[model samples]
Target: MSLQIEMDDPARPDVLALLEEHLRNMHELSPPESVHALDVSRLKTPDITFWSVREGGLLLGCGALRQLSPEHGEIKSMRTPAALRRRGAGRAVLEHILVEAKRRAYTRLSLETGTPAAFDAARRLYESVGFRECGPFGDYRLDPYSVFMTLDLRPQTE
Candidate 1:
């Protein structure tokens, strides 16, 4: 399927619905305090750039890059519809976020995801793109239910 990824307004009805579903899923999978999924209002901040993936005008998935600093960024709200999993839509959104991070000259990209068995696929997907486990960053604190991952975007100096 031809997937198109574009910057999107998080306030739109369809986008809001998808984000709500994502938040609901996170709450179901993780403890209340451990859930860190951002709501639509937070995603509208200037620091966050949100994008949605669509095929034939149907929303397939969405993801975002939040600027942490000049050299750092955080991946947030990456979600593919349950019915559309394993169809490359999530991967496409992720790849697009990584490219956007690089274009913004971020030296590192990090993300926080659940550590439960339900998150295995997500961990594998991030690993496939070189994301490795790391300690919490940004405003995050140590939480057993959360797994932090990071990818270095800087070029090798050698």
Candidate 2:
């Protein structure tokens, strides 16, 4: 399928609507206590950069990056629409975020994904794209229902 990718400010109407839809879906997956969708207000934080993927005029998925430090960044709010889940939208959005992180000179990228059953597909996507399990970073601590992953962007010699 032909996909149009857009890296946009969260203020864009289309992006904001899709983000809301994504969070709604998350809320249904786990209890309110376990749901981890960052609030729309949080995405407005100065540390974050958001992007959405569209197929023709349809928003397929969205993802964001949060600058943690000069050399570190975190991935957040990654979601593929229920209809678009298996069609590569997640991969496209993720690769787009990784490129953006590197463009901003972040040498390490990390993320927190729910450990609930509904999150299995998400975890697989991360692993297939080279993210490896890591301990909690930032202000996160060990949680039974949260899986942490990280990717090192620095070059390494074979």
Candidate 3:
């Protein structure tokens, strides 16, 4: 796929639409309290880095990374529209986030996602990229509807 992944502003019309749909889907799959997806304003914060994946001007997916501290980060707002799933857009955006996190020298990356069946693909994608189940990492508390995962970004030394 000829995908273009770029760090972008969340205020773009197309990106805002995609983020809106993502929030709606999250709420539909989980209760309001369990839906932790950030809105546009939150994604625009200086501590967060947002990215968009596009192909030929079509927005395929979007995601963001929130800096927890100098050495840790959190993945947020990862979404690809239902019609655009399986097109590698989500993975592209995720890989881009991983690279950004590493580039910033973050030693750890964590995320909270829903436990619902609707989120199975997302969980699998994270796992495929070396994310493993872990305890809540930020302000998040333990919740039945939420699953937490983390990836150790430190380079392996032989």
Candidate 4:
């Protein structure tokens, strides 16, 4: 499949629809108080960089990276439509975000996902990329419904 991913504006109609669906899914998987997915307005903030994955002019998936500090970033709003799952769209978007995080000199990248069975695939994706379980980061606090994961972007040393 020919996939093209680029930095995008979250306010675009297509992107807004995808993000709205993402928020709905997040709320479905976790309680409202535990749901942290950003809405269109939050995604458009200066500290957040958004990207959309497309194939042949159709949106495949989207993700965002929010800078938490000079050396740290948070993965946010990663979602591929149900019909688009298992097609590498999610991984492509994630890898693109990881590359951008490193390009921006971020030393660590973290994400918060739900602990429900509906999120098992997402957890596996993050694990496959070397993101291990971690405690809450940024302004997040401990929560039973949330699973936090992080990856260190520093070069490995022998």
Candidate 5:
């Protein structure tokens, strides 16, 4: 299936609805757990940028990269819509984000995901993309429910 991913204002109604659905489902997989789901208002902040992945007329997935500094970024709000999972939408969206990060000159990209069984698929995706386990980078503290990861983007050639 053909796919197109583009950076859009996270405030867009379609993107918000997709993110909300995925975030709600992710939280429900456990209990009332805190997993750093950025609200629409927080997502609209300047430091964070968002993208949506769509195939044909269907929204497949969405993700965001928040600028931590000139050389680093943090992956946020990554989710593949339920109807679009297992069809390479997640991988497509993830690779697009990584390419975007490198294009923006980010040397590193970090992420925090859950430790529950519900996250096994997501963890595999990250690992396949060269992300390795790492310590927390931002304001996060040690939490058993969360696992941190990072990937060093290859240097761009002239």
Candidate 6:
């Protein structure tokens, strides 16, 4: 399938529905206090750039990058529709987010995800893309149910 990823309006009804499903799943998988997924309204902020992946008009997945600083960004709200999981839609969205982060000159990218079994695949996906486990970042604090990961975007010294 030819997947196309592009910046999307969080207010779109279909996009809102997907985000709502993501939020619902996060709440179900983690404790209320540990759930960090943003709702559609929060994702509409200027600091966040959201994207949707579509194939022939079918929404495949979505993700967002929140600028934490001039040199850093946070990955947020990554979700693939149930029917599209394991089909590379999530990976496409993630790689797209990474490209955007680099384009914005962010030196590092980080994310907070759950520690539950439901998140194993997601964690693996992040690791596959070079994201390593990290400490709480941005406004986050250490929490038992949360797993924080980060990818360094700076070029390695020779």
lDDT of 2 by residue, 1-158 (tens): 58777767766786777778877877776667666678778988989887778788787888888999999999998877666677788898899888888898889999999887888888998998799999989988787878899999987789
Clashing pairs in 4: none
**Per-residue CA lDDT of candidate 6, range 65-157, in tens?**
999999999999899988677778899999999998999999999999999898999999999999999999988999999999999999889
Give Cα distance to truth, residue 59, candidate 6, Å.
0.5
Tens-place lDDT digits, model 1, residues 63-101: 999999999999999998887787798899999999999
Tell me the TM-score of model 5: 0.90
Expressed as tens digits, the lDDT of each residue in 1-158 for candidate 3 is 49999889998999999999998888888889888999999999999989999999899999999999999999998988778889999898899999999999999999999998988999999999999999998899999999999999999999
* Clash totals, every prediction: 0, 0, 0, 0, 0, 0
Cα displacement (Å) at residue 21, model 4: 1.1
Clashing pairs in 1: none
Clashing pairs in 6: none
Ranking by lDDT: 1, 3, 4, 6, 5, 2
Candidate 3 residue runs with Cα over 4 Å from true position? none
TM-score of 4: 0.97
TM-score of each: 0.97, 0.89, 0.97, 0.97, 0.90, 0.97
Record all residue pairs in model 5 with backbone atoms less than 3 Å apart, i.e. clashing.
Answer: none
lDDT, candidate 3, equals: 0.93
lDDT-best of 3 and 6: 3
Better of 1 and 5 by TM-score: 1
Q: How many backbone clashes does candidate 2 have?
A: 0
Q: What lDDT, from 0 to 1, does candidate 1 have?
A: 0.94
lDDT of 1 at 61: 90
